[model samples]
Target: MRNVGVREISRRTGFSPATVSNALNNKRGVNKDTAETIRRMAKELGYERSEHLDHIRFVLARKTGKILDEGTFHPGVIEGVERVAAQLKLQTTFTTIELSNREAAAKQAFEITHDMSNGIVLLGTEMAEEDYVLFRDPQAPLVVVDGWSDRLFFESVVTQNENSAFRAVTYLAEHGHRQIGYIAGDYRIKNFPLRERGYRRAMREAGLTIDSKWRVVVGTTVNTSYDAMKEWLSANPPLPTAFFVENDIMALGCMRAMTEQGIRIPEDVSVVGFDDLPYASVCNPPLTTARIPNREMGEIATHRLMDQIREPRDYTCVTHLSTTFVERQSVKFLQS
Candidate 1:
């Protein structure tokens, strides 16, 4: 008899692979009929429960619990973390960091230290290294997501920011764009600072001068992006042929400002953005951006935390996820 694979099962049952996997694992969210069909296929394939799988299942069950809350970063990370935590028999809790006050955010994190469960995950763009150290201890295991701090000595998961930013800008430069402009977000955080460094490095490697009027560093909001772009455009008589935006949110604002003044993308101004957020593909001309593996990174972070908590190992690891350049309608190829 042929072995039943996830894809084969999905094709046969007309259900998604995720649904089939859920049913096979006895996870919630799949209907009874779907579950039965999945089991039947498994049985037909002579699938037998292995001891390793059972122990793995037991650990997973123990790891996932009631609620696993996360802060600041997108909830998509929480979903992946929860799934992995559930596999380990624990749940995840999510909360938002108060951006207005660092002390308030720190207090909230300290409060979570007293939760029913000991495991914690924190995600924040503005979280400092010192704040992370307070949350991390030998007894209580914590994972820092998307931020890097030298003061806090703990395991972390970071998005591949520098390389991704370099790729986006280099793509423009390679395609005959020398007089390039940059719309950057707040440089207070480590990642953005690294990205800024990457941008400067790219510009220097191409033998291009860094003009003050071409760089805009401001808050990570749409309004900030709009105002920054507007200021740059007004101050400079002629705009660059291409521009690189820090994030999708700001990219939207930059596009708005450009369009309002009758500037066209790829025609009058070529544009590329980081973070292929949900709205990136649906924008006016679609956004050419970098895609981050948010969910997978979250899942890996959870699993790493669980291992540290359970095994009490001496291995301290830092994981960096790579980003992909997604070609879309936003960028215009200028043949110069």
Candidate 2:
């Protein structure tokens, strides 16, 4: 059997040399049907794709320190991405870009990634609306992970924030808690507003009165949340029987403050958190929270990027992965 070259494949498939090259190497810019046809013809003609086809770039548009945080959700997601890439025989290069200035960040990101790989997986949690526009017409196929932008259309994989928050609040209501409070995260993050909306909707549905004074907005980190909660608790405001926190880190911080003030968990005030992070299970009383499938979200995002690479198209829909409710000792069942 004779070895086939891209020229031969292109000649036989009646496609341009560039199109054949993109299709055979699994790069974007070719239509799905055409790419499939080229692959089939190339195989029939005994063509072997080059090793460069296996290259991919993972771009994290956040503070490098935050992405490297061992206790956060990003580590699990990165692990999942690496696992899937290995399974697919794809080589991945990880990089981080500071997103403080959208214009400068976009330019830097594009300069770093323009010709480096066949596709890109962008961790867009820190990216703003303008920052995403730079990648909208990317040189290679791109998939945004862990965030969504309403101003642009692109393939995205995000957690079911609204649905997960709804379930957590509903769970609290089912346990005979009518005054449900919310511990909100920074509204700047795209998912926080959705989670807050879900919390409000669930409270309304359960016929619970939402006391504005009980709702508190805190920073995204454990220390910040602890300080904020401590300050809020000093006011001696009427506390809700249960609180649904935006994430496990903040929930644990709030719990710490409550403990410091001699307030008991579940016995006095029940707490539920979103994103069942690793520490959630080992916290003082073990948190009752909604489990965001961080790893699975990463895996799905990688697969979606692969799909876009194989067939370049205008993909507009955002994919949302469902979250599971994790029952733990932190939340108590009140007498109806």
Candidate 3:
């Protein structure tokens, strides 16, 4: 069979040669969908996998239950990883780690990949400082997806949390909302703190008062967040004109709480959320949210891991992708 180069595939798919090469090599710069399309084209053209390429292992560290069960975020990211890996003609494996037993899990993960030349992609936003130490000196290359750490130096790909949150809050402010509240998630996740920081910064910029009563921290899940918001609403604390929630799931939960309390959405309390998950559009009042490119982040992280595997580097960097704002029915515009 004749070998089909990346350029031919790029021409066929309308992707750049670099993007096609990245997809074919299992590198991280291409989006999952584009990479998959390129891979299909390459396969049709008889592109073969190079024996020089190392296999990939995706290590999912879960603070909650399984990553798939947690929410649409992680699953979407995993889908991107799989699609890109398939295009690259690279072998991939998945392993789930319980955060409660991170030390043991990390050790086991290290042992499993110690002798192999495979690279690893660690997916989890809740990874603690100690959890990262286990993979610090793994003989194989590693990359982190949907999470970041200042303490560790692994190459990472994460959403632009701080800026995205700032934009979400600013959207509310622009709509004549000066009294904006925040529905936050557990701060243990690195992204949450960054988002909170952004929310605070935006509120300050808009000359809005940061009311402590309106800022509530709830568990990460939708159900837990719903219960927390319900309890918070019972106190009948002074409500803000608008709220910037950490994620769509939490936003949906808070909306449910508001409805149960007979508070009409957009009329009584306008709300905005982050991570425009699938349910964001289907909710009773479609969510106004900042869309995180989860799958794209996964694709880019995979490419970066491949680079690390090919060229072992002492220094590491984190890549942040920008978010887009999606306007929906959740936030009500007020007279300016």
Candidate 4:
């Protein structure tokens, strides 16, 4: 008969909990002979370190609650990470900090991580370049998701922001749409800018003139997007035949604003969005959008971080998972 857990082994070995943990994780500061003794005692006590460790610490960084709250893209990524970790018989834990105070958040994260024997997967969705620089180094191995930096590089896994946005916009062009507008959430994450770049590139490649007035930047949430779009519509500006919005939530809000103004979806303005959220399929008229493989990104980041933990890498790698363009009823075909 064998018991599972760390404290039991710690008590029997006459070692502090921290020493037991450090020895189990193969972390330094524990004397080599003492660590070996602890391991022997752990084995005798039937403490399965593989099941308890190979662990990862997930750090959710938030600049604001606007996008980091429940029911958003980040949760899917977390689920993916957890699912893979379980398959490997590894453990997962969480910590959160506010990027609103960059220095304090960075310092807090570093201090907390100092004692951790696990690698970290940072939720970089809302992180800016300056924030990235501030957290460029940590006491533990790190992987970042949904964000990247020109100045700093970590083993990163991100969505194919530019490719997906380009595909969405190009789909509109193929449907005989020359006048395509853009809608984006107002935020400081790296994803939005890449999505916008894809939109711009696609428009240019298609030889379609981008109407500067058609580009609207609104709040990151559905309510704020709705309010902003509604206010913009109140001005009675001419609407484009189609729009490629930043994400499904913002798309829904913009859709509501348009419908309220007597603008028929697909009929008046065909629209495409990114992130095929659950609501996309059930909406009044289904939204045609690019589905980001959020969970896959999270899983990959975990694996990558684990690899680094197993064998330290001198060079970092970045992985960008592509999206699936889901065609629904939101876009209407036209003839020139």
Question: Which candidate should be chosen as best, given TM-score against the real structure?
Answer: 4
The TM-score obtained by model 1 is 0.72
How well is each residue in 213-332 modelled by candidate 1, as lDDT tens digits? Answer: 777765466676677777666755578788788777778888888887788886888888877888889988899999888787678877776676457665567889999899998877
Task: Give the top-scoring candidate (lDDT).
Answer: 4
The better-scoring model by lDDT among 3 and 4 is 4
Evaluation by TM-score, superior candidate among 2 and 4? 4
lDDT of 2 by residue, 1-336 (tens): 454666577789899766876776677889999999999997888765322345667787874332234347777778778888899898878877777666777666655444424567788776667677666545456678887778877788898989889989998998899888889865356777889999999988998899998889886678877888998889877788999998887888889988998889989899999888888999989999988888887788788877765665645569888998999999989976
Which model, 2 or 4, shows the larger lDDT?
Answer: 4
Q: State TM-scores per candidate.
A: 0.72, 0.81, 0.81, 0.82
Residue 164 alpha-carbon offset, candidate 3, angstroms: 0.7
Over 133-183, each residue of candidate 3 has an lDDT whose tens digit, in order, gives 666544456778877666767788888999999988888888899889888
Q: Which candidate would rank higher by lDDT, 1 or 4?
A: 4
> What lDDT does the true structure give each of the candidates?
0.67, 0.78, 0.79, 0.82
Candidate 4 residue-wise lDDT, 1-336, digit = tens: 463455566778889766877788777799999999999987777766331234777888888877767346888888988988888877888888888886799676655444335777888877877777656544467888888777976888888999889999998998899999999788746788889999999999999999899999887788999999999999999989999998888899999999999999999999898889989999979999999888888889888876876776568888888899999999999985
Worst 10 residues of 2 by lDDT: 63-72
lDDT at residue 90 of model 3 (Cα atoms) = 85
Which runs of model 2 end up more than 4 angstroms from their true locations?
Answer: 1-52, 63-71, 101-104
The C-alpha RMSD in Å for every predicted model, in order, reads 16.0, 7.2, 12.4, 6.7
